[model samples]
Every structure is written in C-alpha cells, then in structure tokens.
Target: MIENYIATHLIDVAALAILCYLIYSNNILNQNRKWPFYIGIMLTVLIISSEAGTIIAGNANGDLRFLNIFCNVFGFAMSPLIPIILLAIYDVNILLTNKLLMLPSIVNMFATALSPWLGFVFYIDVNNHYERGNLFIVFVTAYILNLIILFISTVRTGQKHHYPIKAKFTALSLFVIAGTSIQLIFPSVYSSWHSVTLSLLLYYLLLSEFDGSFDALTRLHNRAAYDKMVNRLDGRKLYSVIVMDINNFKEINDTFGHDFGDTVLKKVASVIRKSFDNSSTCYRVGGDEFYIISSETDPVKLEHQLKCMTNNLEKERKNDGRLPTVSYGYSIFKGGKGIGFQEVLKEADDQMYYFKKIQQDMKKSTQTS
Candidate 1:
C-alpha cells in the first residue's frame, strides 16, 4: 500500500512539473485569454494536492481526518470545472469570458464545503478514512451531465466552424469517464489522477499536431498536411479527389487589395467546409487552390456532393452578387501508376480547367467590374 502511494505521488508530481514547463514554454497556453490553460493547470494542481492529502492521511493510519476531508472536497469540486474548462479551451464564448459558466463550479465547491455538516458529498470518519454520503450520487450525476454536455457542445461547435473537434473532445471525455469511474469503484486503487494526467499528455500531443497541420489564415489543412495525407494513402483506401480554384482570384486581389482577397479566401474555405462531409478533408494546397479528398469513392455520392457544392457556390455568388466565384471538379481514381492517386489528381486538375473555362465563357467573370 505504501509503495503504491509513493509511486502515484511521484507520477503526479512529475506530470505537474512537465505540464508547467509546457505551459510556460508554449505559446498556445497564452492565446484566447489563456483561461482554458489556466483552468487546466489549476485542475491538475488540485488533483495533485488532493493526492498529497490522501498520502498524508494514509501515512497517519487514517488518523488525519482533516486531510482526508480536504482530499475528498478537492476531488468533488473538480467535477463541474472540468467541463467548463474544456468548453473554454474550445472557445465557447458563453463559458470562457463570462462568470456564468463559473457558477456551476462555484456551487459545487460550496456544497462540497458543507460536506462536513451535511454529509452531502463525502464524510471523514474519526479514523480519517473517507466514505460516500447519502447524497454522494448527486455529485456523480453532475459529473455525468458535464461530460454529456461537453460531448454535445464539442460536436456542435465543430460542425459550425468546420473543425474536426470530435476527435479531441471524444477522446478526452472517454478518458475522464473511464478514469474517474474506475477510481469511484475501487477507491483504494488510487489510479484516477494518474490516468487523467496521461490523458492530458495525449491531448497535448494531439493539439500540437492539429496546430502544426492547419493553415493559420484560412484554417484549412496546409500543403504539408496534404503531403502527409498522400503519404498515408498507400492504395489501401479508395479516394476521390476534388480540386477547386477561385475564379479571377488574381484580379480580385489586384483590384480589392490583399485584405479583401483574404476575406474572399476565407469565405470560399468556409463554403468548402460546409459543403463537404466529415469523411472528406479540405486542404489549402495553393494560394487560391483547395483540394478535398473524400474517402467515399462511390460515383453517385461523389457526383451528388459535387453538385451540392456547385449549387452552394452559386448561392454564395447570388448573395455577394459581385465577388468572384469558385470552380471545382472531382475525379474518382481510375487506376494508373500501379495505384492511381496521381492519376485522379491529374484528371481532377484537367476537369477543373475545363470547368473554369466554361464558367469564364458563360459569365465573363463579374469579378473585374
């Protein structure tokens, strides 16, 4: 038992040190008011301190009732904060900058504070061991609700912004649920905080990859990310390639200025993101060029999706009335180069040129005017 406590404490201490170093050294922690990162750090510290309390109580042969209560209180208070902090990290406006989101956490903390008298969360015995109270399930229920909200909010936010948020949030929620459930079932096992720390490390790695792979201006996958995807497609997965170009883009830039050109690009990227499903990835492969690689190679679905994008672009043109429009063409792999990825790209490029020519011939590009 003593050896287990020592190991858990050492791991928690090392994780906290690494996390502090990462926050200080990395700029991600500084962005978006840094509230998310601050909350994460605070949560980690609270867990670590709680673990310390546990160790102390154990060392005292459960004689330190105060220490045991302190540990349980900290743990209880962390339940509501976890979801709020995650929402903040994902730039949920209502949660991050406003005190409204803090209310739940504050309430939980207050209730946990009254645990000694009310026995609402947990109780410490004269021997200093901890046990759940009558209303202990209330806190557990709150945690479950928090996780569900986090999952739903993350999915909605991702869809609204065309971001792949599900990967990050899903993994995080699952880890927390699994870790905390195990700890709740077997309190003496003492593995919850360590599991959470491990999850944090994994999330950091994922965030780094996400930050590195996406374009800063347009928020689409960058050319480097495109190359990475191409490398991964070793002919095992069937794919269809869609290539797009903003018509009269150079003229739009020269006439409206670079800032306006940037807005146009953002608008087009937004359209592309909204038009495509999660099965496809959009990449900013060039200044005015984007490539959408769809895993679904079914000809009918590809055609339908392509037509939807075309109709969407037409609607966008109608809305803006004067801004330049985008032209796109897609090609399903037809076999060449022993695999045909490049063949599909070349065919898509050809089709894009064909599509652009037709558009120019039809409308004469309302852009220059």
Candidate 2:
C-alpha cells in the first residue's frame, strides 16, 4: 500500500515538473495563448500537490487535516476546469481572455469550495479521510455539463474557422470520461490524475503543431493542411473543390507595392471566409489563390451556396471598388467516380482561365465602346 501511494505521487510530481519545463524552456508560449498555458500549468500543479497531500495525509502519525481539505478542494476544482481550459487552447474568444464568459467557471469553483461548510463537493472526516459529501452528485453533474458545452462550442468554432480540432478534443474528453468512470467504480486505483496529466501533455503537443498548419499572413489553413485534408479524404463523402484566383494580382503588387498587396490578400481571405459556411473548408493554396472544399451533396443547396459565394465576392467590387476582383471554378466527385485529384483540379483551373478570359474581353470591349 505504501508502494502504491509512492508511485502515484511520483507520477503526479513528474507530470507537473515536465509541464513546467515545457513552458519555461520553449518560445511556444506567446501572449495570445500564455494565459491558457499558465492555467494548464496551474491545473497540473494543483493536482500534483493534492495527490502528494493524499499520500502524506495517509500517514497515521501525521496531523494533516488541512492537507486533506486542500486535496478535496483541488480535486473538485480541477475536473470542471478541463473543459474551460480546452476553450482556451482553441483560442476561443469567449472562454479565454474574456472575464464575462468565465462566470460559469467562477460559479462552479465557488460552489465546489463550499464542501467544508455545506458538504456539497467533499469533506474531511474525523479520521482525516476524504469522503464525498451528500451533494457530490451536483458537482459531478456540473462537470459533465461543462464537458458537453465545451464539446459543442469547440466543434462549432472549428467549423466556423474551417479547422478540424474537434476530433482531438473528442478523444481527450473520452479518455477523461473513461478514467473518471474507472476511478468512481474502483476508488482505490487513483488513475484519473495520471490520465489527465498525460492527456494535457498530449493536447499541448498537438497545440504546438497548430502553428505549422496555419498561414501566418491570413491566419487560415495553409497548403500543408490543404494537402493533409485532400490526402486523408475517405472517398465516400461528396467533395466540392472550388479553386479561386485573383484577377491580375500581379498588377496590384506592382502598382501598390508588397505591403498593400499583402493587405489585399488578407482582405480577400476575410471575404472568402465570410462567404463560406461552417460546412466548408477553405485553404490558402497559393499566392493570390484559394481552394474551398465542401461536403454538401444536395445539388440545389450546393449551387445556391456557390452562387451566394459568387455574389459575395462580386458585391465587394461595388461595395469597395478598390478591392481586387477574383474568379473561381469548382469540380466535385463522389465515391466510385474514380476522379483523380489532379484531374479535378485541372478541370477547375481550366474553367477559371475560361472565366478570366471572358472578364478580360468584356473590359476590352467596354474600353473600345
């Protein structure tokens, strides 16, 4: 029994030390995300301290009632926070850097901290043993509800930004859920802390990879992510590949200089993002070019959406006359169609060239008139 306690406590301590090392040793901690990283470190350290307290408090000669209380408080506190931390990881504005959105977490922490007086979250018994109080169910329910909301918000946010981090979050949530279940079923195991530590570690490692997938200029998914998305397609889902290019983008660069040209690209990216719905994936495939992939299979709905995208881009010419014009072409293929990626891209490119020619001719005719 002593050996078991020692091992669990060591693992918890090791996890905290490693996390701290990652933060201090790396430049990955930037201003936009430092708070989430700091919060994550806090969660890990609290768990480590609580677990270590549990070990020391188990000593018969030790008078560590405060340690027992701290353990219970920190333990209850960390569970509800996993979901909140996830919101921060994704850089979700509402959950991170927004005090207003933190009301739920604040309320939860306050309620959980009432374990001593109200016996709602947990309490230390006369023997200095930790025990779940009568209202423990309420805390559990609150944690579960936070997880649900986190999942919904993450998926919806990912869809809005054309990111696919929901799968990662789903995996982490499931792991925590399973670990929590096992701990509840067999209270002696003390495995949930280990699971959480490892999960947080892996999640941060994944977070580090996010920068490579994003385009620095536009903050959209870059060509690397584009390749991954295309290569990993299951071939069963209906895919619409819309290829777009700016009209005479070189002229803008030459006329206004690179700085203004960069502004144009950013503006174009914003317009494209706004035009597409959550169901579509947009990529900055190349300079002055973009690729949007959609799984919408319904012809009428798809065409309607495509038309709206077209109008959205065209409207900018009238709305802001200084914005550069863009043209696009799309080719969709379903399962068993045997259409190669290059072939479809070629088709779209061909159509784009054809459209560009028409626009050029119209300009020439209007000038001659």
Candidate 3:
C-alpha cells in the first residue's frame, strides 16, 4: 500500500525537484519573487508526503494512531495554503493590501490543528481508521475560496499586463480546478499535486515569455513588442496611434542625472497606463518617446484620454518639479486602404514635432518677455 502511494506521487515529486533546481540554477526570479515559488514547491511536497503518511498510518495498528492524527492534521492545515502561495506569485501586494483574504486560511488552520482533540475536521479512531469529522467542510471551503481568488487574480494580472496568452491562463486555472475537483469528489484518486506540479512548470514558462516583451526600466511594452504589434495589426481594423515625446528631456538628463531621467520615464509610463483604458496598449518605443495604440475610433474620446495623460503629468509635477512635460500627436487609420503603418506613424511624428516646436517657441517667448 505504501509502495502504491509512492508510485502515484513519484513523478510529481521528481518534476518539482527538477523545477526547483532549474529555478535556482537559472536565477529565473529575484530573491523576493523566488521565495514564493520555493515555498509553494515545498508546501506541495509536504502535502503529498503527509497524505501518503496518513494512508499508511491509518491502515496500521492502533499503536500508529498518533501518526495518523498528526499526518491528517498537517495535511489539512497545509492543503488550503497552496493556492494562496500561487496567488502570491502573481502579485504579493494583493495579499498585503487585502488582509481579509487570509481570514479563511487562518480559521481553517486553527480548526485543523485542534481536530485531533476536538475531532471537528478529521479524526482517527481507536482502530486507526481515518474518517472525516463534521466540520470537514471548513477545509473544502477554504480551498475553494483560495482557488477562486487565484483565478480572479490571474485574470486581472493578465489584463493589466495586456498578456496575449490569456487563454493559457484560463486553461491552467481550469486544469487545476478539474484536477482538484476530481480528487475531492473521488477521495481515492490522488491527482491534485500532479496537476499543481504541471501548472507551476507551465506558469514559470509563461512568465519568462511575457517578461521578455516588457521594457525593464519603464515596465511598458518595449520596442520589440511595439514592432511586433505593429506588424501584426489587422489591416481591416481601425487604430489610433498616439506618439509622445518628453519636452526638454536632454536638459533634464543633463541637469540631474540619467537616474532621474529614468524615474521620469517610469512616471510618464505610469501616467500613460492609467490614462488609457484596456482598449489601448502603451509602449516605450524609444528614449524619451512613448507610443499608444488604441482601438478607440472616436476622436473626442481619444482627445479626452490625451488630456487625462497630460493632467496626470501636471499632478505628478507637484511632487517633483524636475518632471518634464510632453508634447503629443495622433493619427487615425481607418484601415483597408493602401495606407501603411509607416505612413500613419510618420503623420503622427510630424504632428508631434510640430507640437514640440510650438511649445519651445512659447517657452522662448516667455523668457524673452
């Protein structure tokens, strides 16, 4: 029986072990981000092992009853935590900001801990037989709640980052849900950890692919991503392209430092991200230059979004006087015409330079006055 349990879990354990080695060897994530993966892998391992222990001890003599109770309690306490750890991987700040999210796990932990004595979650009888207690629903509820949170967090993160692989995330969520649900319903089948191991491996690969498309400094889509998006644009779909350049960027870099300039870029990127809706994609296409591609065809709405971006910059300036203003221009492509992307881009660029020239002339006039 113990051999059967080991045989069922051997592949999962080995997969996780290999993943842990790869994570550390490649230095895939920073220290802060890496710990969550490590913890998740560790917890899954513990849960798998304790579950096997529970089965083994439950079938043994009453002398091993203590072991049965310990294993059951440990497994129940740790099982609901896996989803929370997965959630942390996507965005640790979510857990930090929302303390209420932890309430169910905390309650489940205390209940499971006292279950051996109280027999409210699970109990091992004098004959060493394992049986569920009246309040076993506590563990089930906590696990389901955390899974829901994980699913919601994954979707929100994908949307915020404009991840093109949203279908993959959905599949992963459904995969885990199905695997865990099967085990929850069957009780005899051990499939949850197997599913988790595969999910973690896939998630790591997805993050690696997604991170490559982002600008490291500004956290916006990088030039390569921008080019890829431009090349892939459907000629039948309408697009509004907005090009913006920071005013006096060279002066800002020269007066302060490249560090301050980078900060300015990040702030501008944040403003752009907040100003635009999900229908728009923001990119840091070049030094001191940001680009926005919006699906919005309405000119008034596009103008309003641009105004919102500038207003955000003004608000940011109150905190840091060194922050520079931006001049922008936009061009609309109705598509299906002989007009190419380059043509649309050049029109926006010409207008942007014109806007910059006017701003420069006004600054000079004010100085002369």
Q: Which structure among the candidates has the greatest TM-score?
A: 3
lDDT of 3 by residue, 1-369 (tens): 668877878778889999888778754343455779889999988888888887788767999999888888888998888889988977899999988998889999999999988888988778888778899999999998988888788788778776676688878888888988898888778787788888889877776667768888888898988988898886788999999999999999999999998899999999998999988999999898999888887899999999999999999999989899999999999876788888989999999999999999999999999
Q: Order of all candidates by lDDT, from best down to worst?
A: 3, 1, 2
Best candidate, lDDT-wise?
3
Number of backbone-clashing residue pairs for each candidate, in the order shown: 0, 0, 0
Residue 232 CA error for candidate 1 (Å)? 3.9
Better of 2 and 3 by lDDT: 3
Candidate 1 C-alpha lDDT tens digits along 98-210? 55546556666777889977888888777776678887776777777766766786688665534566877787778888988897898777777777677666666655665
True lDDT of residue 273, candidate 3: 89
lDDT of 2 at 186: 83
Estimate TM-scores for all models. 0.72, 0.83, 0.86
Q: Comparing 2 and 3 by TM-score, which wins?
A: 3
Candidate 3: where are CA atoms >4 Å away?
Answer: 7-11, 25-32, 117-119, 251-255, 315-322, 363-369
Q: Of 1 and 2, which scores higher on TM-score?
A: 2
Question: Candidate 2 overall Cα lDDT vs. reference?
Answer: 0.75
Compared with the true structure, what per-residue lDDT tens digits does model 2 show for residues 134-160?
A: 877666776677777777877777667
